[model samples]
Target: MGEVLVLTAAAGVPDAAAAGVAGRATRLAPGAIEVALDRPLPAGFAVPGVDANVVPAERRRKRLLIADMDSTIIGVECIDELADFAGVKAEVAAITERAMRGELDFEAALDARVALLAGLPESVLGECYAERVRLNPGARTLVRTMAALGAETALISGGFSYFTGRVAADAGFARNQANTLLVEGGRLTGRVARPILGRAAKLAALEAITAERGIGVADAIAVGDGANDLDMVRAAGIGVAYHAKPALAAEADARLEHSDLTALLALQGIAADAWVD
Candidate 1:
């Protein structure tokens, strides 16, 4: 068999023939189609609001999933939300935008943003998570479904651990890792812990987890939405850019433009009926 072209849309199923893709079509879900193709689609072919990718039939389902947290699994950037509680949201969010777009050093941008929040009460962490953070649509289903099938799921982020821990548990990830924010005397110390978790650390987590599972990097799938996620996204067998920044999106094996997180399951050939919700 040649490569399988998987198409997922947020609304209706896309027509393979319309895109000049010839193959045996199988409906993986209401808005997902998998086609066994002898030839790749024409160059520049795309359907608005649809995500497309071609993968080897034998390697569609991955054994491990390593994903980013802020702006990927969850709907908001935790740092930006934390900054909001300190009355510096606009200033901090601008830095965050640049950092995610690959224009600023992750650690430096993080330090600058955290510094702006110094003196804010530590209780804001819990309040920010409770009032501002939310898992994006289908996030829970995606993680839980993968875990149910015996895949190891991990949430790795450059964002803070306080948020990662809660998001990971809410989304059903088996494990989680992230940088730590230091608090002193019930107030922000304005410093992230030493040896921050950035792009390199995210990649290291992928490598470490795959090794512990006795599998190659090719057995893993990674998804994220920022430049900080570039290393691991490129290292995984199936790297998905989930509503990503342009830099990361350009390098991803698949881009999820309109669909929610369940699209990842469809990309791996899991039928909608089999999704855990």
Candidate 2:
């Protein structure tokens, strides 16, 4: 058999019909097939006649998982839920959408959004955290599998601690770092603590976690969906953009487009079926 070339479309392009073409080409040795395409390929579709062992070259044996919270671990931005509490979802969400898309300055957008929450009752924070936030589908399975493999997990977010703390516990992260919101007199003071955790801080969290664990950075994987996560995403040995913005998807080394968080396990050579729900 001849070597089969694995092909993928560009970052955003996914053509089922073209993939059918690639699929037929699988008559060649799968190991010999090099996927050269402009966009992402179909999920879970492997070429025939190819040795599974040789098909995936960049197999990850990760020791640490550094995940972003908003739209990654969870379904929605925690901060947007917070904005909903104050009935400022329209105003804050616009800025948040821009910031997450890498269109606006992160710090400036955050400052503007937080400023709008000024004077919202402190109780609203709990309401948003308690009722609004939910783990993204398959998040638990992903975390459990990583932990079972003795990989340490940390949640590093540009989001606030008010949400990340609870999310970390629920998602089973070993450590978490995020910005702190300032509240006074049971109302938002409309300010975040200085040295706000942004892209740089997200990268630092990975460094700190790796240093404390005595693991090399090559054993780490980072996943996120926003522009603020670019620095750390690039820093990780394996970086994934999960349902990310166009810019983020363009920059990430790999992406999860068709499926949920469990799709990530495939990159590590761990199929999702082997993992318990």
| Per-model TM values vs. the true structure | 0.96, 0.80
- Colliding pairs, model 1: none
Q: What are the per-residue Cα lDDT tens digits for candidate 1 across 132-165?
A: 9999988999999999999999999999999999
Worst 10 residues of 2 by lDDT: 25-34
lDDT of 2 by residue, 1-277 (tens): 2222233221212333234433343211111223323333556655332212112344456889999999999998877888888888888888988998889988888899999889999888788887888999778877888888889999888998989899998988878898899999999999999988988888888888899999877678899998999888888877888878887877877766545676555446554445656
Q: Estimate every model's Cα lDDT from 0 to 1.
A: 0.91, 0.74
Of candidate 1, the 10-residue stretch with the lowest lDDT total is 12-21
The numbered model that scores best in lDDT is 1
